[model samples]
Target: MKKYHFIAALLFCSILLQAQERYFLNSDTRLYTSTSTSAEFLGYFKYGAEVQLLSKNENGWYKVKADNLSEGYVPEKFVGTRLNAADIKTVDNENPVLAGGDQYYGGNHLFVLVAGLKARALPDKTSKIKEILFTGDPVPVNYLPKNQDEWVNIGGNFDYENAKFTLRKFIGKRPDFNTLIKEFDKLNPDAIAERKTVAERIVELAWNSDYSKLAPAYQRYSEVVKQLNDPKLIADTELNVSIAKGLDKHKLPEQIVAFTQKTEFILKGIKTKSLFLTQKELVKTFGKPAKTASIGDECGVYLSDLFYYYPDLEVSVDEKQNKAEIVKVFINENNKMILNANSVLDNTITEKAFIEKYGTYITASIKAPHSYSLQFEDSEFRIEFKDGKLFFIEIFFYC
Candidate 1:
């Protein structure tokens, strides 16, 4: 038997905001004729202005009916459901050093700021813009949000986690759950603590509400179990293909398969306190970048040609403070790889394979030739396909 629960009533908050779907402009935002900035400049929306949402493309760009009743594409950064910076709640900032006018990242934390935004002195809506930061800026954080995912206080400046501006991953294939679990049973727990984390995350996602996400979640759950037993479980494709062939397609399999990705990312982010990054670790890994960039008001470093090679990595720092504040790894066509930081993936895989590796991306409504973006509280992923081939995969890591 399947358990069903209706969340449409709870979703009314979003529904009431728009008769259809609607969004707000965070700044005096521009609207383009299409997704590219080089396209025609349709017009601009005033700060805090609301616009009717027409459609959202696979790459996370929005096609909106602007104030003048014109339609065009707007990047997701300047457009959001929230009206102001003050909407994000911040942890107490009583550090005496902050009062002394010293602005340095805590060195213990790194955050990826998802929007190209203006930094405000306070987290309140009325605060003046201190500076502007472009989308994908790896920001150093003084404090991490306790349990919520929507807001981040970065370097004493407040930034909201915008849908387009955060960390994301591109989609590939999904792993079949049938054989994967048999492998799961074969492995022993690496650590009691990690096993506990996995169990807890499982409990957290067990609700039957979004079975669309649940089935894929179960697939991921198995992957995590295998990883804990053998760090390279997914890396061994010979073993993985065999595992997939054995997966059972039972009732409510979608909900069951969709289980583990959240747990994997959350545990990774929380347990590591931060993951494989810091100002020093980045420089040490890739050396000083080949070039420097100034997007909006923030300084960023491009380790390479970006659109050409290794598009997956982004590192930005606050040079004055000599701190590496932003770190990102976006997997796109320019830097396609079989083995990512966590799993091995390629184009031949289905949406299911992708869900296990990167969680849900290409939604049921999106398919070949169209793109879609999935927003997480801390990160975002965009999946794009064309001519029946998957070409883009992007991920941003924000804490």
Candidate 2:
């Protein structure tokens, strides 16, 4: 008798909660078997497809039934009130499947102004997180809903609220801040010096341009400045620091390892057995690095990796393979590493001697304000000359 009463109560609630008004899918949306994003995916509903609204959960997932009697859950953001195809705005050449009709309607660019913004698999808050985006990250906008401004469909992923952002409608090329950040990361000398230069440039730009009105934008800008000013250092153990100090005192090997396609070579009295030396071997030879840093976004999806800094060398390790693949030797005031048999790195080697020894390179260009880089064809080695002398020598795995 109690079980029957419970079943009756559920039926009564379901009938009361059922939506009477019609609703349509605002974008190409996926249907989940359950309310959770981890549930089985039923299928996708085309843009502007009419769906029967069942019930909406507290977390904004809508229980809906498709025309074919396919009952599943779709994000509430995707379900809109009676959408008309003609009323939607669109641009040419956008994907028809992702947009309404043959056009995409939205700003030309979507600039993320906040840090740690999570990209969702669906527009709803309960959807699976695809990636974490940072400040200045330009999200690729594929389609924007005309009815609501709550969520945006970027490629396939979605960002919540769309509050901490700005949109631009220009067709011309714009300054890519993210690319500039990547270039700033690749700057020579050290992370501290590189960040100092970048931070100063950011301040100059911010001061010159019109400031954002949003409070969150101001907060994010402050955070970026703070991060650049106070760069995080790799927490090295005391024993590791001691080992690095001891390794620096030793006299480096005098042999010149030709900067060729060969992976195995002796560098600074330490021998590399393969394209990448294991962390164990690196620690044994050069000791653990003083600071470890990343070159790109924290998610590291595209052009991103880590660099471990020792006393006079920067070691870039491949995260996938867990080995030190790229080694950069910085020739400082003390002349840390000698290169090419007798060529010293302390701004004393002549250009004629460099050309006579290494021969002509495939390309030579100015890399920085006062630095020049030379790259050889069919080789993984690159040499940067500062003050008309060899400054930085880098070698990495070709692949």
Candidate 3:
């Protein structure tokens, strides 16, 4: 009875151990103090040694507790299931499977079309050429295994040499070959799906001129409509096919064209009128006149009478108040052509030339002995006189 009890206890322990998953330490594998190859190598465990899985590290190493009470890390690839004989037979009978689909063999070069041929980096289809021979550019190809199509088998390695040979023919003198290869390597499942979605939308919008109905799929009607109205889309056969045959009957195409034209016109107008006004314009419209001085040179101040409210007086100069005022004036001196009082006839006078020829129109009442200040529309001009002859004129304007 004692021997039977001991045997029963041993059997129970064995069953409990078998219920837990076990890992076997294999050869050519060095155990690390931590779950990283850079960690100190403790030692190598012989093939078929038993280990219990504790946890996994992000670096593809597994931490395992050994039968000797030792703990170490080993590469996950070198660890095998410690299955029983029956389990091994079952696994051997079942063929190991891998996912396979369209495989990107690395070393393939990409050529962008430019001009009339494929160039290194432009978007003209006719100008681009692929390097395929010694006389041609040597291109490299990289495989993107993660971007495999549905039919592709996973876990399959690519023949890098063959891929390179195949892509060399497509490489031209274009220096973008390496960049294209790197991009190909970075291709993943998510990115491919996103690209497909965008391409599909583009095709759909190009075919259907009525983007108003496509609002659910596209957020910005104006932007998507503009893209659909692009000249390139109009020329695309896929876009034409995707669009409804009755698009012309609906007049959506014409509307899109008109809208695009209007938008372009508005943008161009804004650009053209960007530099029309400054703060100086406002100042000129409503600014006070500076002080001035009168020289005894019979100097007469001319103000524009066009915008002026006073129209009764031809020209009046008050020396006592030092104020030169004009009444019944349709044009202000800033807008009048005031030549030398002695040189030209008064009949040749015009409001447009007065401001252009003469300085500011308003002469202020405040004056010095030889100098006087005047206010033009928005500018202030200082007039200096020597013996009643106009000596100097200065005007200041700001941005």
Task: Give lDDT per model, in order.
Answer: 0.39, 0.46, 0.33
Residue 109, model 2: lDDT of: 38
lDDT of 1: 0.39
Quick one: ranking by lDDT, best first?
2, 1, 3
As a TM-score, model 3 comes out at 0.17
Question: Going through the candidates in order, what is the number of backbone clashes in each?
Answer: 45, 0, 67
lDDT of model 1 at residue 177?
33
The C-alpha TM-scores of every prediction are: 0.25, 0.28, 0.17
Q: What tens-digit string does per-residue lDDT give for candidate 1 at 1-399?
A: 011112222223323536555567665446677788778664434354566677755386888754323457777766677765564322223221111122323232232222225554333334446555432223443222222322334442111222111111210112223333344345465654454344323322322123333444345455555655665434432223322332222223344224313321111122111222344554555566766665442222232222212234554555444444323444333233333255443456554345444432223221122344444334444555444345555544343
Candidate 1 error regions (>4 Å):
1-276, 297-311, 320-352, 355-372, 384-392, 395-399
The regions of model 2 sitting more than 4 angstroms off are 1-259, 263-265, 295-304, 318-322, 332-349, 366-380, 395-399
Off by over 4 Å in 3: 1-18, 82-399
Clashing residue pairs in candidate 2 are: none
